[model samples]
Target: MTDKDLRRAVLDELDFDPSLDAGDIGVAVSEGVVTLTGHVGSYAEKVEAERAVRRVRGVRAIAQEIAVRYADAKKVADDQIAARALAIIDWSVHLPKDAIQVTVSGGWITLTGAVPWRYQSRSAEAVVRQLSGVLGVTNRIAIEPRVPPGAVKDKILEAFRRSALFEADAIKVTVSGDRVILEGAVTARAERDAAERAAWSVPGVRAVEDRIVAMARADKMRCTAARIRDRSSIPETNARGTDPSGGRKDTKCSDRGACPVA
Candidate 1:
C-alpha cells in the first residue's frame, strides 16, 4: 500500500478504538513505517494508541513519540502509585510474594528484585502499568537461571517445533551461559515475537537477543490485521499472558523459595 493509504488506515483504526481518545494523536507514514506523535491522557491510552496503529495493515514499524499528560484532578502522587503498585503485586497469585520490589518516581515505576520466571516479571509490569498515574514502567526484575544452558536450548527448539507459527529449522538458537541469541527470518512480525517469547520461556534464559527479521509480506499483514481487529473488541483479561506455543509452566521452587542468583 502507498504511504498515503497506510496513513489513512492508521488514523481510522485509532479513531475506531473507543478505549482511547485519539484527538491529540498524530499519525505520519513513510514507506510502510508509521510514526505516532502528540499526547494522550494516560499511559494506558498511549499504549492503546500504538496497538491501534499496529493493527492496521502495511505498517512495518512504529516510532512512538506520544507523551502522557494527566489532568490536575486526576494526577496521582508518586508515593500513592508506589503503594498501589506494591499492594497489587502482592495480591497477584502469579508472582511470588515479596519477590518483586517497587520504586516510583515522577509517576514511573521501577521494579527490582528477582523471580524464577520471565512471566512473573512481565506480569508484575503489566499489573503495575494499569494503575492510576503510572507514566511508565522499568522492569529490572532478574531471572534466576535454574537449568543448564544445553537444556535451555533444547527446550526452546522443542517449543518452536511444536508451534504452527515457526519453522524450527529456519531459526537458530545459541546459548551462552544464561543468555540466548536467536537469529533467523520469519514472514510476519508476530512470528518473530513468538520466537523470542519461546526462548524466554526456558528455565535458564536470563536474557535473549532477538535477531530474527520479519520479511514484509502483504498477505500476512492483511491476515494479522484482521485478527487484530477481531481481538480489539474483546475485553482485556488480567490472566497470566499466554504464548503461541501452548504456555510456559512455572517452575516449582523449594520451601525456601527461588532466590535471586547473584
Candidate 2:
C-alpha cells in the first residue's frame, strides 16, 4: 500500500482502541514504517498507543518518540510509588512475593530478582506498569528455575492441550537450559501470542523464543518460512528461518531432547 493509505490506516487503528488516547499523538508513515510523536499522560497510554498501531496491516516498523507527560494528580513520591508497587506484587497470585525487588527513581520502576518461570518475571513487571504515576518499567528479574529442566516439550504440549485456546499439534517446542524455542503455525495472531504465553507459564522457562507463524500470512508467503516470535507476540513469520530482524535462529537443543537446567 501507498504511504498515504498506510498513514490513514494507522491513525484509524490508533483511534479504534478504547484504551489509548490517540488525539494528541501524531502519526507519520514512510515506506510503511510508522513514527509516533507527541506526549502521553502516562507510560501505559504510550505503550497502548503503539500496540494499537501494530494491529494495522502493512506496518513494517515503528519509531516511538512520544514523551511521557505525567498528570499533576497522577504524580506521586518515589517512596509512595515503591510502596504501592510492592503491594501490587504481593497481591498477585502469579508472582512470588519475596522473589522480586522493586526500585523507583524518576517515575521509572526497575524490577530485579530471580523467579522460577518467565511468566512470573513478566507478571511482576505487568503489575508495576499499571500503577499510577509510573512513567516506565525496567524488568530485570531473572528466571532461575530450581527444578531440573527436562521434559519441557511434554510439559509445554500438555499446557497447550489443557488450554482451550492453543492447538498442540500445530506447534513444536525445543528447550535449551531455561530457554525455549517455539516453532509451528497457529490459526490467528492471538493464538500465536497465547502459545508463547503458555510456554512462558510453564516452570523452568527462563526465556521463550516464539517462531510460530500465523495462518493469516501463510497465503501471502510460503508456509515454511523459519520465523522467530518477538517478546510482544507480534506476528513476524517467514520462510527464511530467521527472526524479523534477520538474526540467526537459536540452535542449542540437547541430546536429552531438552536442556538440563536446574
Q: CA RMSD for every model?
A: 15.9, 10.2
lDDT of 2 by residue, 1-262 (tens): 6789989988888888888888899999997678999988888888888778766766656899998888788799999999999998999998876988999999899999998778778778777888889989999998777656787767888899888875676677888888889876554556767788888877778788877655444432333232223223555546865446554333332222211110
Assess each prediction's global lDDT (C-alpha) against the native: 0.78, 0.75
The residue pairs in collision within model 1 are none
Candidate 1's TM-score: 0.77
Q: For residue 251, what is the lDDT in candidate 1? A: 28
**How would you encode candidate 1's per-residue C-alpha lDDT over 111-151 as one tens digit per residue?**
99999999888899889988879999898999998897778
- Scored by lDDT, model 2 comes in at 0.75
**TM-scores for every candidate against the unseen true structure:** 0.77, 0.70
